[model samples]
Target: MAGTAPSPSGAAAAAESVSDLNYLLRPLHWTAVLRHPSGAGRSPLCFRLYTFAMASFTLSFFCSEVIVLYREGTADLDVFTLTLSVADTDIIWLFRMAHAIVCERAFHKLALQVGRDFAEFVTWDDIPVLRVQCRKVRRFTLTYISFGIGACSCYLVSPVSAEGLPFILALPFDATQPLGFGVTWVYCMITTLHVVVMTMILDSFNVSLIAQLRMQITLLSSKIVSLAKEVSERPENYSETYAQYELRYRLLKCIRHHQTIIKNADLLERSLGAMLLAQSLSIGASACFQMFQIATSENLALAAYDAVTSLQECPLSLKRSLLLLMHRAQRPLRVTAGGFFPLSRESFVSVVNVSYSFFAILRNFKNEEE
Candidate 1:
């Protein structure tokens, strides 16, 4: 629901395209059902089913990970590599948990606000821009899911050797046995799909939040331009008093829009701040390790893929508004990583550069030792 954008006609039907695909904010919808039963309408039953299934898969995955960690210490080179391979999955789990917490807490209010704004303020003119943003989100979601499937398939299908049967993950129990192996494989496959779906939904939600903010900013910019044009024109039929009153009314309306935009941005920060901080740190480390592995080994395309998957693109108009908004706000609307750095593409590239530098240092140290 959040990710869906109006079409060029500003038709409500445009939002329906994403209704069934709305996998991100079930808490917001269902909680409102409990709070206002008469007004809640019929809720989507699939949201509840998906949520429950993912929860079960998440628990199973976590237990399996713990078992693996306990069985094989990272002291071994192979074990360390194996750990790096599943690093993205671990981070996705963190994001999913953070999202669930936010949804259960205050995200419902934000969702309500978003729906209200879309209904009242968004015009057909705004739809095209919003559609572009939604398309970008969809592309990123597909990329993440595709790469996830590819990685899981590779790991699961690898040949078994004399040392032991290679597992999708490290297990304390003997997975070489038929029953044990079958159960582990199935669990890993299901968990892999779970992670893929969550990653797509959660990441799309982030993009949707930013896109909606950008829409408000774009509308505000247009309003400002229109008001300026109106003030510049003097009509021969208008009285000065009537002109002044009209200007005042328009100005007040514009101010209200501006205020609403700021409030929405603030709400977004409250909902996503902690998760962005964690994501920033996780992605930095993931990118570093990925680049390192890519440089040193050939079987690490998955790492490279993970490094690329989290990047989100901003539209050109939205980019301009971001600059304007930053200039207006003394503090700016930045999502910071522990107050050290902002979570953005520039920062992501910087992290990659830092990772490369660290890899160089490690390589030099190894060479010196040799």
Candidate 2:
């Protein structure tokens, strides 16, 4: 009965809400990070070839930089700093690319499952909640993409003004010659832009998944609260048996909804766990960004408890179901990185502190050397 006989307009709204998830991931599909959700079977041959070529180029560029750095040495402070910066960028890019490739299947399945959930669980009344979250996601995606592109443009243009390649690498031909310089510049431009865009898309994809999970948890809490209200307001003419049956039916739906949320959370963790761990270590704010979902999930237990406690008279069987819901909610859904650490505020603070300590040590070492 949930999705049955929806009005044409209502159905359109539901489809729009469902499309948000796919829209957020459209870039990933184009980049071959993950195949299109609508397509079946393995990714097309062209996508595979594109992925291979981009990955090969990235790895080759990284290796070239490292070899050149090693051959020239890093005794000069400027050269040392430049080499470090280049290495950091290339390493992170390679790590992200590798992670995407490894988790491609998991990501593909997770995206499809989430899409189905959106289509089935979203209703006319649920439109407001979905819309709110969708707007936030759209805003975030736009801001992130704009900032990344703007920054990358500046980086690429700076080299042009200075009459140098965007990145320093040892090529076979003399890059200073006009023809060689033109080819080298174009190559750097293409590879650098690809890395920047791919990194942004991957990060956005993960964030969008977290947002979807939080939205589902919010919906579950809303359903539980509504269940209590509806049961309490039952008409006086209704028979006790009928009331009990209705309550049980509605409660069962809520339970199933909770289960779906749990399943999706697990899938998300499996798909991005190791990648998240790497991100948290590399970017101090990554863990902090995930704390919102954790907080929302933890509140679900309290919501369930309050909803059930408000009922004046409840059947023992119904109470048992409510108790089970509370117990399950108390666990507080979490997404962990490689099953090693949960992404939370505490983890964020720890990562920041560790990063700062390393920076301080490096500073001291440099000062001493100077």
Candidate 3:
């Protein structure tokens, strides 16, 4: 709000006619975003490397899930060709969560700070459109919240887990392991496409939010300058007190506008960051999960790099995780789905065995942690 750019001739006219569209609409090249945003302060490569690694893991895990589902005969061959319609409800809520974080918590409080800054600059007429956008964001956010609840609660409760116990995962060491390497590549291609398309869509939403903020800021800047000029030119036509009041009123209005913009940006920062975080987690978890799956059929060291590359997957790993978790319904019913109630299994010992076995497998590995 304080940094003043030197004004150009007819700047006000140009501002009024400037394009309202604020962000780029094309699919993203994450490298560019990281390069520009990180500048001299932090290593952009740090985040990029971490994210890319995570994404790779997620795709691998998802491919494992798809393979498992195929083994169960629940999905069709066409599923291999189909693009999944993403469940964006979680996304919308993620945005809301960011807003609440800024408004109510510490990490995103910058939103409030920025909002306060922007409020110092805009007017009343501009408020209506901005308000409308806020309301839309709210509604979008609420729907996402509702969706997350339903996905976790409604679909996770399965019946098969308790009944069969460990029969499914008991690895018939000789159980004709899943498809061959050719099949692995097939699975990779399918999953890779899923990741790409979904990520583009996901990235677009964040970019759109940024674009909207940019456009609004430009509009508000013009309005503020226009108001200042009008007051200056007409001062002789009004009483001293009236002119002072008008000036104060306009300044206050701008303050409010500045606050709103700042709030929105802050909300977006956290929201966008959280989104990327969620994606990162998905990518990492799914990649690990897939590595675990591939290890099930193929050699562990055979494709370490491919395992790492799974992070490039666009949509990251959340949906894949959800889908894989959904498959858990038939496997051991750790999650909800297939029935309205929890499985009737003995809990404490089973949980311990599963947890212990998962870690014990690690100790036997002769390979370095690399």
The candidate that achieves the highest lDDT relative to the unseen native structure: 2
Best by TM-score: 2
Candidate rank order under lDDT: 2, 1, 3
> What TM value does model 1 have?
0.60
Q: Report the lDDT tens digits of candidate 1 across residue range 78-187.
A: 55555654645565565656465545434545445544544445544555665776677667766775676676677656644222434335466777788877776677
**What local distance difference test score does each model get?**
0.58, 0.72, 0.43
Q: Write the per-residue lDDT of candidate 3 for residues 1-370, one digit (tens) a residue.
A: 1223344223322322231222222122232222221132465467456445535544444444454445645243222222111212223323433332233333223222323334334334444555566556545644554454454343323222222211121122332334433343343333333344334434544544565577577667766777767776783657888778877876787677777778777766655665666666655554444344333333333343344456455464754554454444334313222554332234435767889997887766623542
Task: Please give the clash total of every predicted structure, in order.
Answer: 0, 0, 39
Task: Give each model a TM-score.
Answer: 0.60, 0.71, 0.32
Query: Residue 342 in model 3: shift from native, Å?
Result: 57
The residue pairs found clashing in candidate 1 are none
lDDT of 1: 0.58
Worst 10 residues of 2 by lDDT: 284-293
In candidate 3, residue 146 scores what lDDT? 49
lDDT winner between 1 and 3, please give it.
Answer: 1
